[model samples]
Target: MIARVFGASFVVTILSLVVAFLYAGWSGVALCAILGILEISLSFDNAVINATILERMSPMWQKIFLTVGILIAVVGMRLLFPLVIVWATAGLNPVDAMDLALNPPADGAATFADGSASYETLLTDAHPQIAAFGGMFLIMLFLDFVFDDSGVTWLSPIEGPLGRLGRLPGASTVVALAALVTAAQFAADDATVSVLTAGILGLFTYLVVNGLTGLIEQDEPDDSAGPSEAVKAVGKAGLFLFLYLEVLDASFSFDGVIGAFAITSDPILIALGLGFIGAMFVRSITVYMVRAGTLSEYRYLEHGAHWAIGALAVIMLVSVDENIEVPEIVTGLIGVAFIGAATLSSIWANRRDAARQSASPVAD
Candidate 1:
């Protein structure tokens, strides 16, 4: 099962390394390897959260995710998206944006000969809006899950009250809006409008996608319905779910893309490392978890992933104040710690349950 799931990722990783080596010799290879590892560390929680959604999708849709979805992730988000951002923010034409990204200004040069901001500068300038949008979306996701009372919870003391509050209609939306407004207040004067607007848009996007998905899935097919009807229902729901997953991935990628500039300004290396290597491994991990029934066995895994997401959301919002900066490693470690703690708790619970079962008298 492991080989079946990870074989393609392994092949991709090797090819990425080879390309990196040819691009910039050993230094390129090293940088590519580091960025790949960084992406995996930062996105392990993403894999867990993805599995929760992907497991609900049909087999055909699942295949599409590995095929079409991956192209969007690697090419659309990692490569083209950054160029688009630079173009939009810096008033550069498409060709100019691509050229600037391909050949960044020398070290310590913030702008080009014509005085326009460099690709990295423009991308950094756009971070506040990016963070605000992605942060709000992720916080909404985390809040909805924590508020949900239906699932096994790892943090009962905290989640219990949140779940109770969730019974109120639109509780998550109210809280998310409140958060966006509060964060906007702390943003730089110039960035205040952008932050609020982006955050609201993020909140709106979540509502539209999640609402449509819920409305479509609320009516389960009756026993009298033919198999074709069931298939159609699954197909519709799967499409929306696939969309939700893609947006979720985009939110997760925002930080990684920004952080990659810090390590290396080369767009090609960033694509090879984060897009090709990191994303491939993450998708494989997601598939493995679903196929192995890991979520059901561990029980608390989803809870841990959500908690990590909450931490990430808070960190992103906090970092919107240009004066403050949170290291990417700190964010990655916090996620790993939460997931590790949850795994330990799950193992303990399983052992206790086994003991109780063994102690009971045999029904026979």
Candidate 2:
């Protein structure tokens, strides 16, 4: 089963590589690989969170996530979205932007109507937006951790009581909406607003997708005892699992999709590299967790990832202003630290459980 999954992903990866090589040759291939690894590593926490969501989905949905959803991410978001941005903002005719992106300009100066490159110009022009995005992300994270009603909060020492005070119904959603409104206002004036908007978009997307999914989920009918019934149950579970997986995948891809700009401006390379290679690895890792039922076994892993997501959200929020700067490295490392600690804690938990079982009475 693992081989089949990896094999399929490898095929896609190879196709992406071919496209990259065709566009920019060896340099493009090398750059894509390096960026792919960086994107995957930086998003390890995202993988964990995605697995948690997948565990709750139905099998059919999981398949959709792996297939159709990936196509959207790689083709629609990673490739097309950037092109759209360049076209809309930079006033490049749609065809021209597409042409420039597909066949990059020979010289940076030759790429633009203004004698500058689109990618470089967009990114540089977008520095304020990127900075804004980072700030807003951080703030969203803070609000999430601070306001969560989860039982396994690491911030309980402070949040346990204080959090209780402002815990209103739908507070997180409200804050997310507010963040979005703020971002919309400042998106034009400052890049920070755009960052804030993206974080809000992330939160809003999560809630809407998950909520709709829960409402549509069908309950399993009980049967006296039959293999057929068990099979039906498994099928339903997989469908729901796939839906949740897609939602999670979309959320996790947000940063990496945007962050791909930091690596190279070749939209083709970004989409092919991050969308296919990077995201494929993430999906593989997520599937491993689902198949292994890692979350069921390790209670704190999801918690750690959520905490990290919450932290990143908060970072995004604060980044709206110039008062602070939160590096992507710091954001990623903080997530990694949380996951590392959770892994150790999970091991400790398993050991404790085993010890207890050994000490308990057994039937003769």
Candidate 3:
């Protein structure tokens, strides 16, 4: 099991180094290697969450996520997504945007040829809106989990009440909106439109994903699904889940992409280092978690993952403050701490359960 994990990391590191060296010599190789590790550390929670969803999926869908889905995640989200954002924010045509992206001007210089904004300025300038969107989306995710009307309670003191309140469908939205309002202050006054629009879109993304799932999975009135019907439903249901997973993956990757820029303004290197290589390892970790039944074995693992996400969402929102730069390692450690504590708790619970079972009367 460790070998599987190690092997994946090893292969990804090699690929990252090869790409990095080809691009910017040994320095690039070292930088990309660091970015790869950074990606893995920051996104460990993402892997856990992905595993929770992936384990329930059909084998074929699982493979799809591992293979084709990784490509989309790496190229589409990591590469094209950043470029598209630059184009839209900079208000440039495709060719000009591509040129600006490939050749960013010096800091504070015009990004566009006509002493206009450069890709780095435009991209970094777009951070507040990005943070707002990603932050709102993740907060909604955390809220939904805590507010679930389930009897289970990991952090009962807080989660129990939240679960009760979550019974009201509108509750999560309200909370997310409140978060947006607080985060909006971080955006430049002029960026009000961007922040609000992006934040709302984040909320809408969650709603649409849920709405689609409910639409497809809802039972028909006065009718029961037959075997064939059930089979078709199963396929459709997995598709909804796939959509959810992709959105979730996107949300998780948002901060990573932004952070990658801090390492290097070159989107190509960012794609190779954090996007491509890191994505491969993340997919591998998800598959490993699923196959290992880690969630089932350590029941609190999911809770830890969600909690890590909650922390991340908060950090991302507050990160608009230049004075408060949370170290990347700090972010990674937060998730690791949660998971580590949860693992210990799970072990204790398992042992106690075993003891109780042993003490109970044996059936003849």
Candidate 4:
């Protein structure tokens, strides 16, 4: 198992470096390595949550997630998506924007020829949007998990409709329509509007993927080793869990994708570095959860990761329109606290069970 894990990591690392070197020369390799380490460190809980969901999936879906899902995440999200946003909004010619990203601009330039802003400026400018999305996303997540009530909750106004709509086929269509309207509204000149569009894109992307994947696997059996009744219950739970994990992964990747602008805007490099390393870690952690059965054993770990995701989502959303901020370090610390507490609880539960068993008479 360790060998398999090591092999997967090594392959992903090599892919990241190859893409990095091809785009940035020798320096790119170093950049890729650094990004890989950073991503791996930041995404441990993401993997745990993913694994919990994956364990409840059929092997076919698992394979699709590892293969096709990774491609969409790495290439679609980290690389191509950003470039398309810049081209559409900034009015910069695609090739020029590509060149500017590959080679760093002169010491100080606010806007590229296409009128697209610098990565730093653009990302900094977009923070509010990121924050807003994060905030809304987290609020919804938390309220869904904690409240357990249909109405009178903290986010009753939005959550009530969203939860109901989210259960329907039309949610993705509504989001897409919203995105089109958002883009058209800023047809003249407004990077802020474009940023808003991007955030919506991320949100809709989650809904679309979750909805589609859920539909595809709706009829499949749950897991390989669990019981039939457990499978039915866990299958539904796993589907919801999978949806949450995917969104959580996207949320975690948001800042990193934006930060990659600072490293080099070469969309290819950005995609490769973030995609290979980030997706690899996500997959590894997902597999680790299934293989280890951590959720069943630890019990509260999923709760911890979800809570962390909820918090990060809130931080990102609230800051979308304002400068409200929370560091990633804080996010990690919060998750660790929850997991540690859960672990202690699990240990206590195990000991109690052991004592109960020992106290019972044996049929010798």
Candidate 5:
């Protein structure tokens, strides 16, 4: 099962090597291989979050997520999304953006028409917007979990209280916005407005998506009806899940795209290196978690991942400060630690359940 689940990793390793070899020879191939690992390390928590959402979807949507969604992840985000940023920030034409990507100049030369900031420099300037948007969106997700009293707790002391407060309507959104505003106040004077706007947009995006999903999913049937219920399952492939997954995936990739620039600002390399290989691994992990029923079996996995996401969100928010540099490794390690502890806790929980069942008073 593990081998089958991780098959995509093997395939991606070979593909990344081949693509890198063709693009930049042996040295480049080695770098690509390193990048593939880096991408996975940076996004292990992403797989957990993706699994949480993927489980809500039907089989058809799951397959679509693994296939078509990955392509969009590669082409749309890693490739074109940066170009869109360049266009929006630097006021460059599409052709000019494409040219800049294909042939990125040195540090000082990545430029707008007026040559104020280079392309990469322009991208760095936009990090606050990306951070604000992705951070608020993600922090809201964490808050939603913590706010819900019914859910199992991983960090009960912290989470249990938060979950109780969640009884207040819109508590999560309010908290998230307050955090955003707090971060915005410390932002660069020139960037304060954009940061706030982007943070609000993130909050708005979450509300719209969550509200729309509820509306569409109100009529959907339960998944427990067994295989005889293919009709009901097929109907579950509504646009809401697709949109939700795409937005969720986008939030997950925000850091990777920015961090990719750290490794190599060449957009094409970023596309092939992080986009293809890293994304494929994430898809595979999502599928594996679903097939294994990881969430159901290990109750607190979702909670831990959400907490890790919250940390990531805060890290991103604080990163807007000029002096801050949250290493990619630090982000990855924080998530991995949370997930590892949760896994151990789940194992202990299973053992306790087993012992309780074994020691139950028997019918004579």
Candidate 6:
């Protein structure tokens, strides 16, 4: 099962490494490898969150996610998205933006023909808006999860009250908007408007996607319905869920894409590393989790992933302050720590349950 799931990712990783080596020798290979690891570390929780959604999708939709959805992730989000950002923010034509990306100055400090900052600089310059949007979206996701009264609770003291409060209408939106406003205050004066606008758009995007998904699912036939009706309902819901997963991925990738520039500004390496290798493995991991029933086996795993997402949202918001710097490693470690702790807790809980069952009286 492991080989079947990860085989494609392995092939892609090899090809990406070879391409990196051919493009810029050993240094390129090293940078590509590092960026790939960085992306995986940052996105492990993403795979968990994705699996929760993917499990509900039909088999056909699942295949599409592994195929067409991957194309969008690798090409659209990883490569073209950054270029488009640079183009739109830098006020350069698409052709020039592509050129600037493909052929960065050797010194890593050269400006554009109009004497604007370098490609990397412009991309980083757009980070405030990016962070605001992605951060708000993730904040909403985390808040909604914690606010949910269903399922097991990992942190009862905190999640319990939040869940009770979440019963109020539009609780998640109110909290997310409050967070958006708070994050905006920390933004530089020039970036404040952009931050607020992006954050609101992000919140709006989540509402639209989530609302449509809920509406579609609500129309699904009950158990007494015919197989055909059930299949149709699943298809409709799956389509919207697939879209939700993609947008969630885009939100997750925002930090990784911007952080990649810190290691190397070469667009090819970034695409090869984060897009091909890193993203492929994340998809494989998502599939593995679904097939293995990891979430079911480890009760608190989902809670851990959501908690990590909350941490990431805060990190992104806090990062809007140029004076404060949070290392990518710090972000990665916090996620890993949460997941690790959850796994341990799950194991302990399983053992305790087993012991209780053994101690219970049985019927003759």
Model 4 root-mean-square deviation: 7.0
Candidate ranking under lDDT, highest first, comes to 1, 6, 5, 3, 2, 4
| Candidate 2 lDDT, 229-331, residue by residue in tens | 4433234445554555554555455456666656676777787788888888787778788888888788778767766776666555454444455666787
Q: List the residue pairs that clash in candidate 6.
A: none
Please report, in order, the local distance difference test score of every candidate based on alpha carbons.
0.89, 0.65, 0.79, 0.61, 0.81, 0.89
**Any runs in candidate 4 off by more than 4 Å, and if so which?**
18-26, 108-116, 148-248, 261-269, 359-364
TM-score of each: 0.95, 0.77, 0.88, 0.71, 0.92, 0.95
| Per-residue error (Å), model 2, residue 82 | 1.1
Best by lDDT: 1
**Deviation in Å, model 4, residue 85 alpha carbon:** 2.7
Q: Count clashing residue pairs in model 5.
A: 2
Regions more than 4 Å wrong, model 6: 110-115, 221-233
| Candidate 3 lDDT by residue in tens digits, 197-252 | 89899999988986776676564221355543343334676678688888888888
Residue 57 displacement (Å), model 1: 0.3
Alpha carbon deviation, residue 87, candidate 1 (Å): 1.7
Please give the range of 10 consecutive residues that has the lowest summed lDDT in model 3.
220-229
How would you encode candidate 6's per-residue C-alpha lDDT over 1-364 as one tens digit per residue? 9999999999999999999999999999999999899899899999999999887777677888888888989898888898889887878876777777777766776575667677788888899899988999999999999989885699889888999999998999998898889889989999999899999999999999989988988886445556644543365787898899999999999989989988998888998999999998999999999889999999999999999999999999888877777889999999999999989999999999999999999989
- Model 5 agreement with the true structure over 251-280: per-residue lDDT tens digits: 878888888767777676777778788878
Give Cα distance to truth, residue 338, candidate 4, Å.
Answer: 3.0
Worst 10 contiguous positions by lDDT, candidate 4: 146-155
Task: lDDT winner between 2 and 6, please give it.
Answer: 6
Off by over 4 Å in 3: 1-12, 106-116, 218-234, 320-324, 361-364
